[model samples]
Structure formats: structure tokens, C-alpha cells
Target: MLYAAINAKDHAVYTLSTVHSWRISLSISPPSPLPPSQMTQEQYILASQPNPLQRTGCAQAYPVGIYGWRKRCLYFFILLLLVTMIVNLALTIWILKVMNFTVDGMGNLRVTKEGIRLEGVSEFLLPLYVKEIQSRRDSPLIMQSDRNVTVNARNNIGQLTGQLTVGSEMVEAQCQRFEVRSSDGERVLFSADEQEISIGTEKLKVTGNEGVVFEHSVETSHVRAEPFQDLKLESPTRTLTLEAPKGVEVSAGVGEFKASCRKDLTLESTEGDIFLNANTIRLGNLPHGTTDPLLAPGTTYAKQTVYEVCVCPSGKLYLSPAESASTCQTTNSVCLWS
Candidate 1:
């Protein structure tokens, strides 16, 4: 559409009109060929600090920083993620320490759903204390320590039941009674206490490689035999000595008493007269005996033929001929005993 228009009657009259137009523009350029004093001007830009670099013309370059919002946000997110991971790791370690987690159980020790377990021997640089231990089976429970091993047992009410202590120099087992049992668990092989020591089997045998000596008397001691069997005491070398300070007496309740010797058997009194008191007195092996001092003439037995019995004042026996019997009775002397 035309901005200037005429009516039909006026359009025929507008043919000779002349057109007029105008143009507009804006600029901040300096004036041409001005004096240096007149060209002095100032411009203020709201921008960041600029870097020190070569500049040209009347314009300056403000330094470019983290370029855009996306880059700055990316860097900040990365830093935040790193901090979060570090904190999570620190907290996990602290929890493990407080709960006593088995970090050392990486090798021989194991941590499982059931509990903490040990697969093999674990030697610690320091002493180990724990609530329990599972060890080998069917073997002796031997514990070794340089100093000592003490075992104490307590009942449910906290009363002590037994105490066993073993050390470098001494060992002690304290209880009312101590028992030793067989591996088969059939019977008690031996049992002892402060007042009694019992041997449950048929016989008790004590032996040693060199010598077995019982030096002190025991309390409530006994040696028993099997059913209907005899209790025997023996020394294989035939050397045994038993002494009592008081006088000795022998009695046979239901059996005959017998005395045996390999050589001479002598009964002598040092300060009293010898007496034989019995319902009937009978001498054995009268003339056939050979322990007479006067008859020991270094000759064989066949060389001596006849002998007589002599009586001494000290009740000792001697041999004499029948013809010297009357003289033997009057020749009584204590020397006849020898």
C-alpha cells in the first residue's frame, strides 16, 4: 500500500509532483584528524579483569574464564563426588575398628556367616586372648609355655572346682580328688585325693628303669590282689631289708607259718637265757647235723663215726662221744655256745 494517495479527481492532477526521501544511521567513531588533546576519551565496560597481553587499536580483551555454565558445573560436580567417596571410605574403616572386625583374618583366620574361624595355626607377635578355640581331635591336649600354664575351672555359681598349674619349676593340681581314666572310658585306672589313692584295676604295678623307691609313708595306702590270688613282694636279686624300731611279731591266722633260708638260720638272744616252751619239745637231725665247731676238723664227713650230745649252760647244743657224756655234764661253760 502507498502512503500517499489521491482521489480519482485529484489523481489526474498529481502527475507532475516530485518525490522526496531521507536516510538515518548511528556511529561512535572518532572524528577525523583531531588533535591528540582532543582525541583523549574514556570507555567503561562491565567485564572481568583482563590479562596482560599485546593490545591493538582502542579496544581491549577481557580474559575468558571457565567458558560456560556447563563446564563450571561439571568441575564442581567432580569435586563433590571425590569428597563423598573419601568420607564414605573413612566411615567404613572407623566402623570396622569399633566392631572389632577380623581384618587380620585374611589368611589363616576366616570370617564367615557362622562366626570367626581359624583354618590353620596362627602365631601372633603378641599374646592372644579369645573366648574359645577349636583344636585338633584324638590327640593329647598339650599346652606349652616358657613360664607357666594355669587352668582354673569354676561352677555356675562362681565357686572354684579345680585348679591346675604347671610352671618351669613346679606343677600343682589342686582338687578334692584327682582321677586318671583309660582311653576306652570303661573304668577309672587310677584315682587319688588328699586322703586316699585308689587303684581300680586288678593290680597296681610301679616300676622304674633304675630303681623305684617309696621314700615317704602315704596316707590311706593299700596293696591288694586279684580274687583268690596271693599278694607278692619280691626283689629279683634276693636282697631286701625291712626294719622296725619296736619288737616284731608274726601271726598266721588261717595258714601255717614257714621260715626258709638258703644258709644258716640262727635265733640268738644277746642278754637273756634261751628257753624253749612247748607242750612237747622234739630235736630234729640229732647226730646227723653238722654245724658243730669242735667237729670241724677239715676232714670228710665219712671220717667221723660216732658222736655224743653235750649241754651248755647257755642252752646251746654241742657234739661229744658217749664215753665223755658224764664229763660233758660237769664241763658246762658259756664258751660251749660258740
Candidate 2:
């Protein structure tokens, strides 16, 4: 029984020592040098476990040192900034080269060239104000507008060597009156609502319309009418006088003619014969039935000397040389000689 008891005590001590040594070995044992392919599942799991002696913090928790998610974002931002700055510097250099500007010793920037060329369409939003706009080249400066354009000036003068043409459906000038004057001021074409056309010291010509009319008296050196048709003269209640150096001749188509002169009527021709012809003849104040001897064409006679004629009661006529006639046997009437 004593020996058995001693053996049991030794077994307990050995088992305890074995357990303590195993724990100590486990605590201080180095990891296996073998690769994952050669290591056992349990050894691999042991090697993969986190080291307790290693430092652990917010920064150290990530696989890459000092390069966490936040740090990556900051790095990308800085990289983008650097790239943008480099691009801006390059564009600035290009612009400066294109502009051709130079800096002088006085630190003033100046244009080194004369011309400036723009690539694309350029627009100016503000008004293009200028004191004067002039074209230096021979090409004309043209301004075009889709709608109406007006120019207003207090005084405007235009001298054109070439012809001026105005084309439109209608053109009008409006004012109280208008006048066109010659250089010497002697000739003018004046027009107004109240005043008629007055042409001074110049010939007035009107065409392509109705004939002219004289509202008042017209005194001219001569008057001429050249018409394609007939010429007419009208005097309603006035006298018309036509005086010419030569004689007057009137010719017309076959028509009746009648002329009446008031008071005394005289028919005289300086170098022409007088002709009187008709179907019948009448003399003095006698009617057509009178049988007097004077009505006979060859009965009336006249002597060159003065004479007096006497008419008797029997209708017999006798003549005497004296103013008184008493030679008739019957009572006689004295007649005066003509």
C-alpha cells in the first residue's frame, strides 16, 4: 500500500509538470517555417492568427501603412489639383505667345506686332460706341438693316458727283412749303398750298398730263400752239384781238358762213376785187311788186354836172340846170342835185 501511494504521487507530479511545460512551450513556441502547402490545418490556423505583440490602432488596422481610405481620397485630390495647375500654366503660356506682347524695361506690357487674329466667332454684347467711324481702305463701309432705318440731322449737306437714284414705291417730302433755287437765286421753283407754282427767271415745263390753264391775265411776247388736233379760241363776253404783220386767211370745211357788224359795215380790200352774186336782186327799200322805172336795170341815169329833178303830178319827171324847176306846164316839185 505504501509503495502504491508513492507511485501515485509521482504520476501526479509528472503529469502536472508535463502540463506546465506544455503550456510554457505553447506560450514561447515559434511559428512553423513550413509553407501553407506543407502545414497542417491546425498549424495554418495558428500561423494565421493575429500577433498579440503587434501595435494596434486606427492607422495600424489597415493593410497598407499610412494609406487608408481617407488618405487615398486626399492623395487623389492633390493629384487633380497639380494636374489642373499644370494645364492652366500651359494655356497661359500659349495665350501669351499668341498675343505677341512684350514687357519693356519699365515693366509695361506692349503689343509687339500689328495684327491680331481671332479663330472663332467673337461677339460683343455691349454697345460699340465711337466718336467717329471711318474706313481707311478703299472699300466702302456698308450698313444694312432688315427693317426701316432713319437718319436725323439738324443740318445735312450731301455733294454727289455721280447720279443719285432713289427707288421705292412711294417717296414724299413734307413741310409747310418747299423751294428749289438756282445758284444765282434768280431762278426758283416755289410751291405751297396757298401759293401757286411761281417759276422765276426760268422756263417752266410740264409734261405728260393735262393742258395748261391761265387763271389770270398772261402777257407774253408771243404765243404758240402746236397741237395734233384742232386749235380753238373762246371769248365768252370779251373781245379777242389777233394782230399780225401779214394778212389773215381762214379756211374751213364746207359750212355756212354768217357775219354781222354793228353800226356801220365797211367792206374794203386793199388789192382785191369785190364780188356780190346771188340768185335774185333787190334795190333800195322797195318791195318785190313795185313797177317803178328806177327798178329797171338800165332806166336810172346820172350826168357829170350838178342837176335838179322835178316830179309832176302825172308822175312824169323832168330836169333843169337851176335849183328851181318851173318849166313844167303843171304844178312841179323842186329836187336838189346830189
Query: What lDDT does candidate 2 reach at residue 181?
Result: 77
- In model 2, where is the ten-residue run with the lowest total lDDT? 9-18
**Clashing pairs counted in every model:** 1, 0
RMSD of each predicted structure: 17.9, 23.8
For the record, the alpha-carbon RMSD of candidate 1 to the native fold, in angstroms, is 17.9
Q: On a 0 to 1 TM-score scale, where does candidate 2 land against the true structure?
A: 0.24
Across 1-338, the per-residue lDDT of candidate 1 in tens digits comes to 12332333212111122223321111122222334554434311111224233235543323433447977898999999999999999999988777556755554556767577665444455646566655647644456776787777777797989989998989899988998888998899899988767878766555544444554443323444445644454566555444445544554456555666788777776887778676987566643324334544442333345665675555566554444324354333333444
Task: Give model 1's TM-score versus the native structure.
Answer: 0.42
What TM-score do all the candidates reach, one by one?
0.42, 0.24
Judged by whole-model lDDT over C-alpha atoms, candidate 1 comes out at 0.55
Model 1 lDDT, residue 136, Cα: 47
Pairs with steric clashes in candidate 1 = 308-320
